[model samples]
Target: MAWYGQIEQLQTIFDELERLLPSGAQLTSFIATTVHFMDCLINNQRGNLFTNVYHNSTVRPFLLPYIPSYARLSHRKWFRYAFIHAFHYYCSFEDFEDERIYIEAIFLANGYSLDFVKYHWRQFLKRFNFSLIELTDLN
Candidate 1:
């Protein structure tokens, strides 16, 4: 989908989340952070902004490459699903890590379900870790 369409879809999801979640400082903070994350992800300059930071040896190999054709076809849905999972993982784990507060705050504000988030988190960890292990063995 086009960037505008993606933004619209995210806005709709946020609206639904707002309706479902209770009002409070926690909710407000989560919503703000979620919106900011979405904006950053969708922004054209995001590659230049965070790609290097995020592509460290610890994380880079697990990330899907930014190949437009593959992204447009084979991996678009996977990318979306992985991102949702990543966001949730970042949120729940960060509660313990403290240093991850910025990313965690965004996920909480977005109002993704804890159950769904947890499920995704496990899947992401399993898949990425498996891939990392396989790559290491090959090397």
Candidate 2:
């Protein structure tokens, strides 16, 4: 098929897909250097692609509350899991630190003490053999 015919075919497909969606919602597409999908921000700089975690502004931050009614072990496990998630998703140290602060705030608002968060954060760094300086320098 000719290149122009292929373009028309692609447009027709996109129109059909948009019609399948509910009313008032449109299927928009892009051909760009950057794209945000699900929870990831992806970028193509030249030929190298980079990805980092993406948070939508409309969404609120939430985590399991560290209240007395819940088991302490469960609270601790979830607390540590937040750190693990931050480490896994953030490609840059600056982004990770921002996420770290956000994580602490969410827990604090949900009743976890600052001391509790600080101690676990320190332990997490230690277990990963990461000093504050090293973490910053490496990323």
Candidate 3:
């Protein structure tokens, strides 16, 4: 499926999950199911590689500009964590090696160092694996 299609599929699942949230289901269960749903949407039986790329580089640029500067500044730890998660999600979904390199350049031009990007990249991978395992029971 195309990217927008995948996103729409996730949105539909989110809408369903939101409806389920008030049912007193365990928060961990809800989040795990939600993440698993997103994983399935992106992976679509193809496997992990595409999902990784889509989650990381392709999605970062759009998301970065929208994050409130105050939030990014004052909540640096949380922001970094969230950013890495989103980036990892994008990277997980798409193959974009050249785009990854390009995004690194853009990040540098925008005042982030390659080291910073790499740090998040590694962090995301770790979290991604853990989350995937937690969500799908497929570690």
Candidate 4:
């Protein structure tokens, strides 16, 4: 009964969130979606449930609509430092068996968009068996 109550609460929240911000919405809707995603994160912490909420997402996609037309990404070594910490944090939690994480890390390091990586996910998957040095050699 208690779990069902939590599910109901989440459903209510998502209902209001999606009603206001359907996919490919305007800039304001994009911003609101980001807020909703954050709220979703705050509400979930068990790390074991497959809620299909914001946990299954990356922040860049929501914020991309808000980015200006003149926006550009300049890859720098400093950014790698932060990513190193983030990558290790995820690795520490997982068994380090998922190759997709490493490929995603490389894409992020090179300033690639999530959509780009996802589109080429199959090619990335083929490289899963590559050695550590081989992984680093990817473009």
What are the per-residue Cα lDDT tens digits for candidate 4 across 1-139? 0143455676676678777885776423221112344323222244332211233345443222233554454332223332333333342223232434654665665567777655455433343453545444432
TM-score of each: 0.25, 0.60, 0.32, 0.23
- Winner on TM-score (1 vs 4): 1
Query: Which regions of candidate 3 fall more than 4 Å away from where they truly are?
Result: 1-94, 130-139
List per-candidate RMSD values in Å: 18.2, 7.0, 10.9, 13.3
lDDT of 2 at 16: 93
Q: Any residue pairs clashing in model 2, and if so which?
A: none
Residue 67 alpha-carbon offset, candidate 3, angstroms: 6.7
Scored by lDDT, the top model is 2
Q: After aligning candidate 4 to the native by TM-score, how far in Å is the CA of 53 from where it should be? A: 18
Instruction: Put down candidate 3 lDDT per residue, 79-102, tens digits, no spaces.
Output: 355545444455332333344455
Per-model lDDT: 0.41, 0.76, 0.48, 0.41
**Model 2 C-alpha lDDT versus the unseen true structure:** 0.76
Question: By summed lDDT, which 10 consecutive residues of candidate 4 come out lowest?
Answer: 26-35
Report the C-alpha displacement of residue 16, candidate 4, in angstroms. 0.3
In candidate 4 the C-alpha lDDT for residue 39 amounts to 21
How far residue 90's Cα lies from its native spot in candidate 3, in Å, is 8.2
* Candidate 1 lDDT trough over 10 residues, lowest sum: 46-55
Clashing pairs in 4: none
Candidate 2 Cα outliers beyond 4 Å, as residue runs: 1-38, 45-48, 56-59, 63-70
